[model samples]
Target: MVTFLLGFTLSVLQPVTGLRGFDTPNDAGGNITLTWESPDSGKVMVEIFRSQSPLEGYQKVESVLSSRREFVDTSAIDGIKYYYYVVSIGEDGKTDRSEILGPVSSAPQWFNTKRWNVLIILILLIIIFFIFIRLAKKGTKTYIRKIPGLEALDDAVGRSTEMGKPILYVPGLWGLTNVTVLASLSILRRVAKKTADYGARILIPNAEPLVMTATQEVVKEAYLEAGRPDLYNERDIFFVTADQFGYAAGCDGIIVRERPGAIFLLGVFAAESLILAETGNSIGAIQIAGTTSTLQLPFFVASCDYTLIGEEMLAAASYLSKEPVMLGSLKGEDFAKIIVSLLIIVGTVLATLGFTRIIELLSTG
Candidate 1:
């Protein structure tokens, strides 16, 4: 009777209470969330334990402050039943355990509801793209801002013709797989057409053999389009060395010897950007340079007469082509960017005014 009374008193003295375990929501499988009422007793540490059975094999999983009411067990295996409990340790090191809570398991959700905002935004953008595509097919013209670098293409070509010197076109150092190289190819077609129109010579030296072959076709097509296919010389579009610095040195030699009246640098470049640009600058060539490399842009801007910055180079093809499909897609994307920017501004204002539900609505997790 005395032992029984002492055990009952200790049970009643336990400070930890109301422990519960459940599958974590909006997550992949293999996780369980444990929650408990915060210990009301003075200064304590809470330890979390897990077990396969309610009565045995319990293992300590985590420890947190008594003020904490929740913990996530990331080690929980999917589809495996587990038991959990909490033990609160007082300042004096006395521990009080809560009743075992169990039979909880983890399973993955097919769709995380927390990412609803991502779904909505994606759907909205798709709808906008389709709308613009339809409008473009109906012959609606989309207005785009002028990029001065592209605007100077004609002047560069005219200058080369008047000076009676060949126009040097460098299709950059990267392979054809790069987007900037592809963009450069598009601009090349326009330059080739102009050169063909004026009966002027054009020289295209490439760093990649594949790019050399592709440039031949692009320039050939441009000349044909300009009704001057007979003047298309495959010899003019040739491959230079693939070695980076060697290619730069080869281009520098061409600039110094041939002294191209106008130099068009439009593609992905690295350290060689300055080398090529500076060489062309020293020759007094009418230089037009563009690239997506931020590190290389300052060099181009400083050395070249015309520099296409960032998206300006990306948008140059569409701007020059005036193809309805390309223009419409470009316009639609610009609108989507504007809408996202406005949403951010509005969300900021609402949050500052203590109305943060707008932010909550857009949260992805």
Candidate 2:
């Protein structure tokens, strides 16, 4: 009973287990190295756990080598962040865990806010609000900004019309619910108007059925807005298979048969990103792609001509239509970034000086 109790005490202290040598390399394979001195004379195996994100649940990996003093992880994906922890198991089959040490992530982050973060957020909101008000009062050239990617649509549509072919606009997998999806749909509206104006054909191949319906509304509205309602075609903006690869295959088939001059892939995409872009590339179509999903970002960078990363995709929306809300949001985001930058600098200085106040603040407040 006494030995059992000691094991139990060690288990309870998992959150505070004293250890050392925790570091992570976010680039490449997203590996992290964990090493520590086993309590002298303690015959026990160490264990590790990891999670894809902070909010996710932890999962056990494997025990640390008994003879060795280190464990290096190689299973994590590049770009995405992961969390890690260590544990020790005793000879009697008793177990104890160390505190979670790492949350190594390669993906770039905009901010890390705590305590005074709220103040910084408020400052950003105010800045954005005022920018919009100022722009409205001045009747500024902010009337409408032009994104280069969006500007290409007219040329793509005209070329398609001249060749007696259709233009392919893929709103991606995120239906109309995602803000990026909505932005992509807004661009779809412009594409519809341009195609209608030149008497060209436009096809919206949607992976989500819901996007199929939304694209219909967006295209029809664009035609009505352009005073060419007769040019709209319901069959053009239709659903493809929902499976990512299946959708890519169907669209690839369409490209080979119909031969769209330009292909716009906006909003979310995943593993099938390169496949679709390569397909479009093979058929000699001008492709413009944008996405916020970090996992698939590299593929877009490699395959597409214009790839919008991080908040650039958001900025593209305002660039397209000059919406006050988006512009204001951008101002807010900038202030938020400034606040985050200041906090990072201050935190580094404080942490180096061993000031526990901020840690306490993070914990309690």
Q: What's each prediction's TM-score?
A: 0.78, 0.62
Range of the 10 consecutive residues with the lowest summed lDDT in candidate 2: 13-22
For every model shown, the clashing-pair count is: 0, 0
Per residue, candidate 2 scores C-alpha lDDT tens digits across 157-201 of 787788787899888877667888877777777788888888788
How high is the CA lDDT of each candidate model? 0.90, 0.72
lDDT of 1 by residue, 1-365 (tens): 99998865554434666778889999989999988776464546888888999889999999898788889999999999999888888777877778888899999998889898888899999999889978988998677888899999999999999999999999899998999999999999999999999999999888999999999999999999999999999998998899999999999999999999999999999999999999999999999999999999999999999999988888988899888888888888998999999999999999999997987997886
Model 1, stretches more than 4 Å misplaced?
A: 1-15, 51-58, 77-81, 87-100, 108-118, 158-163, 175-178, 193-201, 206-245, 347-365
TM-score of candidate 2 relative to the true fold: 0.62
Worst 10 residues of 1 by lDDT: 7-16
> Which candidate number has the best TM-score?
1
Cα shift from native, residue 157, model 2 (Å): 2.7
